[model samples]
Target chain A: MILTVTLNTALDITYRVRSLRPHTSHRVSEVTERPGGKGVNVARVLAALGHEVTVTGFTGGATGRVVQERLASVPGVVDALVPITCATRRTIAVVDDRSGDTTQLNEPGPTVTPAEWSAFQEAYEALLPTASAVALCGSLPPGVPVGAYAGLVRTARSAGIPVLLDTSGEPLRRGVAARPDLIKPNTDELAELTGSHDPVRATQDARRRGAGAVVASLGREGLLAATRDGRWRATPPAPVHGNPTGAGDSAVAGLLSGLIEHLPWPDRLTRATALSAATVAAPVAGEFDQGAYEELLGQVVVSGEASAA
Target chain B: MILTVTLNTALDITYRVRSLRPHTSHRVSEVTERPGGKGVNVARVLAALGHEVTVTGFTGGATGRVVQERLASVPGVVDALVPITCATRRTIAVVDDRSGDTTQLNEPGPTVTPAEWSAFQEAYEALLPTASAVALCGSLPPGVPVGAYAGLVRTARSAGIPVLLDTSGEPLRRGVAARPDLIKPNTDELAELTGSHDPVRATQDARRRGAGAVVASLGREGLLAATRDGRWRATPPAPVHGNPTGAGDSAVAGLLSGLIEHLPWPDRLTRATALSAATVAAPVAGEFDQGAYEELLGQVVVSGEASAA
Candidate 1:
């Protein structure tokens, strides 16, 4: 089973209006909600791909209850979430039907007391032993140590579990030093981490900072990998245009699932690239179009030339 | 004790953002939640004025639980809410800090099943015996009979309780035929009900259609009241400018409280006008500045001119 940790889980709400004009009242034509966060999104995609996934995170208050209740319906997903004192946050995306554009409003997640942090640490450690691979994803909510992911990485390594860390800012800077099995940084995150705009050079620099392997997502351009054994670049047949909200999480799911299945690096890269493109082509996050995924699976080109990174 | 019935209750959420640009993302800086609906807001204002207020409405699901929990904090306000199969609605007001303009998105309230409506009616009848006065306010949710308020008005009247009906559309038209003790209509609602945009003629037409008394809210111009005893027009000291969202609800609270206190027609009109203006001058809904209420109380002009109506 794959284990994913989301420190800051959210009740994702989407409001659809005819036109999202500033300073005007809207009769939201429709509203949709789902359990969300980077790791939760990753786990959902992994489960959809026929992997048994266990999700651990903080959930509290009414919104948190709703998230857990919704998660109960997804098959092969275990809820090992820890309860907190404060309610979970809600992220609203206002979709304008006129222009098909989305405006996001994100609430700052609940603050964790010191005692809650220790409890979460215990829970994470307890869940780590039964997992073949673990994923530490998303932002560090208030009251959590900035280096919290680094400690979790060490724990997973101690348990002999393959760990993948996906985060940005100071958390990423600190977690990279713990040497996770893999790190996926998008173009902006890579630039923010290594101060280099070029994906290939930044991935190399990120590896030098201490990552077993570095995979940088370059948006529509696809995934670039730099590892100690080799370097490769995987590209989709064409640029897929749709909501790219959870594309990176789907890519993470692809890589983690492939790792557990013991696929070669080239095959893993192909799956990751195709899954990312399929997610981008789908209507919502964490869900990929199976038709698109199957069609693009055979078409993704992975070239390993040492200079590909 | 004042009893206010909100058939369609809501969890009011306010989000603060730097600027609300369509098609762009926003990092909401602040979030605030409150129990709200027209009757709920009226009850809150009455409770703040030192009256014991009981709020009854439909509450179900997680959002409904949050609404009930929030009401527990307000002193002198009792929650006599009824449970339903569907969850109560949520109303979100996105406030743009840069422009100070709010974009409102209101969810259509839950559809009340037949059994739920019967249960709510039973609850309302049980609470009516102890109420000094009763207020039936706001829109009717889906699956409820449009003439539901008319039957409620009859129930309150049968119990010898003075009932005030505040709503719009077909419900308001049918409710007027029941001859509710009082009916409060704004300019637009009055126009739609009486087919006249002129407040004076529209108010007279509303009374002629069987309302015992009619109070017409003229926005900045204040209130115009036409009762069996006499007719009067109450105007504020000056044109108060601020959020007018809950001003009418405050006016309803003022009238309800004054009716229970045995105030004269002119005195009731003056208090209603002052409270309405005070609520408008305040920063948020359902709250009145005490100083503004006191200052406007003495200055409100209640001219008992026959030509006022």
Candidate 2:
């Protein structure tokens, strides 16, 4: 069973308006709501692809309840979030039709007290024995220590479960030190963390920081991965031209699924690109297009590393 | 007992930040969540001030469940909303500290299918006998006919209840024709409905259009009411400068509290002004300040019309 942790889950709301005039009233033509956050999105795609997954994090108040209820409704999803005092955050993506760009408004996640953090740690430890792989996604909420994910990674490693850490900033920095099996960082996140824009060099720097493997998701350019077997790059066919909100999470899902199934490096990259493209091509918010996934699987081209032996 | 109907109730979230930038990330310093909507706020303040209040309309889905759970926790409060398939809306209030002004991002309310509307009508009718006064508040959600509020007012009137309608646009236009006992339109809403910027003339026009009485909430200047006795202008103690987010709803709470207690028009205006000022002074997101209310009560001035006496 695959386990995902979303310390700061959100009830994501997207509103489509003709044009965005800040500080003014707007009559929204359409509105969409979904349970969202990096880990939640990853778990959803995996479940849709028929993977047994459990999502546990800190969810509280009404928003938290809604998130839990939504996870339950989705097939192959197990919700494991520990309750907290504060309500979970909500992230609003206001899409402007004229510009075709989304203006994001995010709420700072709820503060998880020391006791709540301890409770989550206990829950994760309890579930670690049965989990084949664990994916830690998103940022740390207030009152939670910066190295929270690092502690979880260490615990999962001690239990002999592969940990896939995908987060930015210091959380990634600290979590990498625990030597997680895999880390997925988008191009911007890779640059910010390693202070290097070159994906290949940044992946090497991240591996030196103690990550077993690094998969860098470069939005349109596609996925570049550095593993023990060799390095590989996969690109999708043309541009899918759709909302790229959960594309990276979908890539993470694909890579993790391939790892457990023991697929070759090139095949892993193909699935990763296919899933990422499928996420963007999906019409519904937070859903992946299965038809696109099947069509895209054949279209992704995987290239071997120029330097790898 | 005063009953307030918010067809599209919401979980009002206010995030306090230094400044708001479009397409850029913000770290909110303070966050607050409250059960909200025009009628919900009215009921909340009335309950806080020791008035019996019930909230009715359509509330369902997980968000709706949270609304009911939270309202149940508040003392002196009752709820009668019918269940619906869609989740209730969430209104985001972004407060910029530098300017101290609020930018509101409201979600379009949930769509109420014809079956859902029938359920709401049935539930509201059954509860009317228990309410001495009923208030129809906020805008109508999509799929609800324009004359929806008007029909609700007519139903309440037939049950011998004095209906107070607080809404805007077509809902307000159609609702007033049902001859609600009072319709409280803000200065802008009054102008929009009557096509007159002049408050006195606007109130007269609103009354002329079938509202038994017109009470226009004039920001900074307090409330202007045209009643059977005369036209009265209520002024707050000082310009209680704060986010005026829910001040109008607070005023409605005071007015309904006064009506239920059989207070004179002057006293009602005084209470309304005090409550509105208290809301500004409260500092808490959705609560009115009781201390401010007590202090402002003595400072409120009610001056009657020159022509009516």
Candidate 3:
């Protein structure tokens, strides 16, 4: 079983309009709602691939109830949420029909008190020992200590569970120091973290910072895997265009599922790359076209290189 | 006592950003939430002015609970919501800091069942006998009978309560034949309803259809009130710039407050115009600048003209 932690979850609301007029009234053509958070999205994709997944996070108020209910309703994912005092955050995506672009308005997520963190840690510790791997994903909410993900990674390591850290900025910087088994950062985020735009160089920088392996997701380009076995790149069969809201999460799901399936490094990279491509091409957030992914997986070509030493 | 009906209420959410960039992420500078609907906004302003207000409408689910909680928290307002299975709608306002303009995205309200409408009608009938007037406001949700407001206004008239209808689309078209004592239509809505851009001619056309009085809210230009007592044109001292959401609703509150206060036609027109101006000048929705309104009320010049008929 894979344990995924989404510290800050949201009720994602997407509105479709002909065009986004900055200061005008618009009649939206449609509205779509979903449970959103990096880890949740990862778990959704994993469950779709028939992986056993447990999602844990902080939730509160009516929006929290909505997130929990929606998460539970998804076929194969298990929800384990810690109750808090504040409502879950809401993320609005305004899609402009004419330009096919999206404008995201995200609310800073709810604050989690020290006591709530302690409760969450306890729940996580109990689950980690029974899980194959733990993925710490998403942003840190207010009131949470900046090094919260590091603490979670340490606990999972203590339980002999391999931890995969997927986050950005401060949390990512701090968590990387704790020596997680894997760290998945996209091209820009990789460049931001390592100051190197070259995928090989950035992956090397990430691994040197204590990540045992690094999977770099390059938007439209493909996936780069830097593991102990070797370095490999897998590209999708064709380039696809759509909203890339959950592309990174889908890659994380692919990487984690690959590990659970005991696939070789090359096959794992292929799977991650194909799934990420499918996610980028998906019409909605946190959902992927399985058939597209499967077809893409068969076409992925992985050329190997010596591991960074 | 004044009665306000928001058949499809909302939890109005506003997000303030420096600019709206499509398909890009934005960090909201500020956020505000208020209980809203056309009638709800009217009730809020009236309550601030120290009027006895009872809101009678269909409300259910968590969103409805939030609305009820907010209304209960505000002083000088009473809630008498009839229960329904559907949750109330939510309205999103995205404001651009540079342009000082708002982009409003309104959700389709809950589908009200026939049983729900019947229950709501019973609740309205129970409240009408004790209320002095009724303000029917906002769009009718799906599953609600198209002429829902017409039936409601007839019930209010039977109880000797003057009904004021404020809505648009088919609901307004159907409800007009019920002969509401007052109908507050904006300039464009007035043009759409009467098929004339000229406010003076359009107002007479509105009265000819079924309204006893037509209080046309002409935004910055001001108020045009055609009543049994007399017709008056009231304009503000100056055009105040700010978020104008709910400004018309505030005008409805001012007009209703004046009627209960026994202010003459001219005084009522002036007060309503000032309140509308104050609402437009306020930084937030459902909030009016009392000092500005008081100052502007004194400057409002009410002029009269004999009817062409």
| Candidate closest to the true structure, highest DockQ | 1
* Pairs that clash in candidate 1: none
DockQ metric for all predictions: 0.85, 0.50, 0.67
Interface RMSD per candidate (angstroms): 0.8, 2.0, 1.5
Candidate 1 per-residue lDDT, tens place, A1-309, comes to 899999999999998899888888888888889999899999999999999999998998999999999999989899999999998999998888888788888999899999999999999988887999999999988999999999999999999999999999999999999989899999999999999998889999999998999999988999999987689999999999989989999999999999999988888999999999999999875589999999999999999865434
lDDT of 3 at B268: 86
Model 3 has a DockQ score of 0.67
- Order of candidates by lDDT, top first? 1, 2, 3
Identify the superior model by lDDT, candidate 1 or candidate 2.
Answer: 1
What is the C-alpha lDDT profile of model 2 across A1-309, one tens digit per residue? 999999999988788877876666667777777789999999999998889999989899877887877778988999888899998898878787898777777888888899999999999999999998999999988899999888999999999998999999999999999899999999888998899999999998999989999999989889998888788889999888888889999999998999889888799899999999988988765578999999999999999764446
Comparing 1 and 3 by TM-score, which wins? Answer: 1
- The segments of candidate 1 whose C-alpha lies over 4 angstroms from its true place after superposition are A306-309, B306-309
- lDDT of model 3, residue A146: 92
Interface RMSD of 1: 0.8
Task: Please write out the lDDT profile of model 1 over residues B91-193, one tens digit for every residue.
Answer: 9999888788898988878989999999999999999999999999999989899999999999999999999999998999999999899999999999999
- In what order do the candidates fall by TM-score, top score first? 1, 3, 2
Q: Candidate 2, which segments miss by more than 4 Å at Cα?
A: A80-86, A113-119, A191-198, A237-241, A281-287, A291-299, A305-309, B113-126, B143-145, B155-159, B191-198, B235-240, B285-302, B305-309
How large is the C-alpha RMSD of every model relative to the true structure?
1.8, 3.4, 2.3
Q: Which 10-residue span in candidate 1 chain A carries the lowest summed lDDT?
A: A300-309
Top-scoring candidate (lDDT): 1
TM-score of 2: 0.88
